[model samples]
Target: MSSFRVMRCQPLAREAGSVKKPLNHLLVSAFVYAGLGVASGLFYREFTKLNGFPEGAFTQLGLAHTHLLSLGFFPFLILLGLERAFTFSASRKRFGWFLGLYHAGVILTSAMLIVHGCLTVLGLESSAMISGIAGLGHMAITAAIIVLFLALRTAVRGVERPAAVAA
Candidate 1:
């Protein structure tokens, strides 16, 4: 009897508010990521000659640029499109966590990669520290991807249930 009551309560609790808001947040985040990518690239080009083609500088900048564009920009865009195409629920917490992780990963990784790379080129930091920062950035990105996937999957499942019919 208690099990049945708990089971009944679970479904009711899950059936909450609209999930559109989170999806919109993801879309906006994607656009911002795209813009960031472009800005980074432009800066790289402008500063490359002035900074000199120091070892690892170009490589780091290129890695940061690619990650920003591919992971940061495209993932959110794809999420938004998926939400629209599948009509997924827009659970705010679900989407919020995903966006938060995504943005945090991008910002941290990009910043570290750029700064460490530049510092390395300028002969400020040792190679090991730069490598460590890059590794941390990569881990952040991986965590963000996991969060996005889980949120998307959950939202899609939520929307697949049949709507209650009126008598």
Candidate 2:
């Protein structure tokens, strides 16, 4: 292996002009997703009851609750841990883009699910446009995943183990 420096990998917060902005953002996103997930669950129950929808019937609202909790809340929590560990936000531009795209995708996808669910409960047919928009949201999520992978790769590449000191 090549020679290593003791202080090679420094936390971004320790760097000049750096802050914990990414961590804070990630934490807030996790909480927001958690809230959304709970609210969607409640909405599913209440809306179906109000509409006299049959019990045990499948609805997009149920899926939305799971999606919000699994895809939105869990992912954000995981990203928070990753950010704390690797400081991937050091790649500021990429991180920002990833955050914006990811949040947009989650919100768009969940919103469509809620709308479609309501339509179904009300016995109304949904337009193809809703499905199309959800597809676009999924695409955005896919792109955000790629961006996150690249950012994590960059952060990992920047990290180096300290060399042992000679006796």
Candidate 3:
């Protein structure tokens, strides 16, 4: 009976460390990205209207809204689902690295978009430096993707398959 209780508790103990904390972080990140996305949309509309930006004028503002939603908000939500299946927190260090690099990339990219958009709306020419910084952000995002896959691979390999049921 003691051994039976220990066997049942083992999985529960592992789960306490591996799932709840990381899932909470992902949930918080998702909501944050959602708020930022909405704010960016509002900022684009108002800032452009105040500047009398022409309807057909090209701007990065619109792209920023979509990018935040798609890249930032949606990815976190998707990771939440993946966490359930793969237990990504199993590789905690790699997961931490991924979170750091990914968030940095998203923030840098979105900030540059806002800056470039504001400059364009105000009839100012953007510098090559802005473009260079944005490129670095993309590179960081790419690196994070590689890190995520590495972490996922580790988690997947660690999962144990159940024995086949008797026919």
C-alpha lDDT values of all predictions: 0.65, 0.87, 0.86
What are the per-residue Cα lDDT tens digits for candidate 1 across 53-145? 653444466566777898788877777777665543345565566556657767888887777656645657556765676677677667766
lDDT of 3: 0.86
TM-score for all models, in order of appearance: 0.70, 0.89, 0.90
Report, for all candidates in order, the number of backbone clashes.
3, 0, 0
Ranking by TM-score: 3, 2, 1
* Residue-wise C-alpha lDDT for candidate 3, range 1-167, written one tens digit per residue: 22322221111126465578999999999999999999999999999999899987889977899889998999999999888777877787899999999999999999999999999999999999999999888999999999999998877777766544444
Clashes of 3: 0
The predicted structure with the larger lDDT, 1 or 3, is 3
Clashing pairs in 3: none
Per-residue lDDT of candidate 2, residues 11-30 (tens digit): 44455446567788899999
TM-score of 2: 0.89
Candidate structures ordered by lDDT, highest first: 2, 3, 1
lDDT measured at residue 60 in model 1 versus the true structure, 0 to 100: 66
Model 1: pairs clashing at backbone N, Cα or C within 3 Å: 19-90, 19-91, 20-90
